[model samples]
Target: MPATAGERPLTPAGRRVLEVASALFYERGIGQVGMELIAAEAGVTKKTVYDRFGSKEALVLAYLRARDERWRAFLDERLAAAPSPRERVLATFDALGEWLRAESARGCSMVNAVAEVPAPDHPVHRVAAEQKSWLRGLYADLIVQAGHGDAGGLADRLALLHEGAVVMFSVGAMADAPEIARDTAAALLP
Candidate 1:
């Protein structure tokens, strides 16, 4: 019988494969990395990699999912320490800044993956879109909690600023994009 959805658990070796793939995929563009490279670096055979993830596309989706999970955890941790809803919203930028500077100075993994993936219907592309939408929703929820009217509009503006900052930072046009974004977000908050 075929396995049901979500039935497969990641074994230790599979987790290692994902960890290596996540790092390689982030450091190098997705297109630059291949299953063989991932397998070699992960100390697993190409067959093992395929047996674990089923396909390269599946592995890419797993990598993005893992990255997204870590990102959300990081943002939540930062937001949790804020004393106010406004600070919580601003803290999201702070969290992003730290993440970009320390973990991924190159740019957003999702955005980068989207650029490499040729098809809109690819699992990685869907995951990337969902990640952005999740961030926008988080911003909107915080804005509402902070007593802001037109939370959706505010969220859209803030999300745009966030995306702009990431692009600028990635292109070396702005080293302090996150801080700048935070300040601009403050002004947007009524």
Candidate 2:
């Protein structure tokens, strides 16, 4: 059983379960972490975990949602502080770089989750897809605001650059990937 859209808010105990499970899922892989471990680490019983989240799959969805929300808030803050649309676009990558260094040196959490969870129809997959869509939309909107023509096309290119930098940075193939991406973006902007 999974949580519905109208599901009631998480109880304090449920929140604890999410907190513990999110850390574990991000630190470990989704497939690697079991509900039992999450329950144990959360200081709750297995039944409580199931009772709160309904299922392991639901818990995974909750974890991804929590991560995505945090990321959006972080990126939004950085973008808000930028003086120009172009700077806002670049600030996104800057935020990503900061996030990579501070939180997830391993890689993008959504990407990691996508790699681990192969089922395309899974709720986790939808969450991952939603994150990517949101990012591309943000880039498109910013590019248009920056007075760039063919905003959609440029947005796609920028999104690729952004994702490439994350992959390169995660694999240690490019120490300056974020800066490089920003430089490439500056050239791409009209």
For residue 174, give model 2's deviation from the true position in Å.
1.5
User: Which 10 consecutive residues of model 2 have the lowest summed lDDT?
Assistant: 1-10
How many clashes would you count in candidate 2? Answer: 0
Candidate 2, 1-190: lDDT as tens digits? 1242447688888999998998999898888999899999999999999988888888888888888888889998999999998899999989988988888788888999989988898777888888899889999999989988899999999999999999999989998899999999989887
- Models, CA RMSD each: 2.6, 2.0
- Relative to the unseen true structure, what is the C-alpha lDDT of residue 48 in candidate 2, on a scale of 0 to 100? 93
TM-score of 1: 0.95
Reference-based lDDT, each prediction: 0.87, 0.88
Q: Per-residue lDDT for 102 in model 1?
A: 84
- Give a tens-digit lDDT track for model 1, residues 20-110: 9889998987789999999999999999899988888788888888888988888889999999999999998999799888887888889
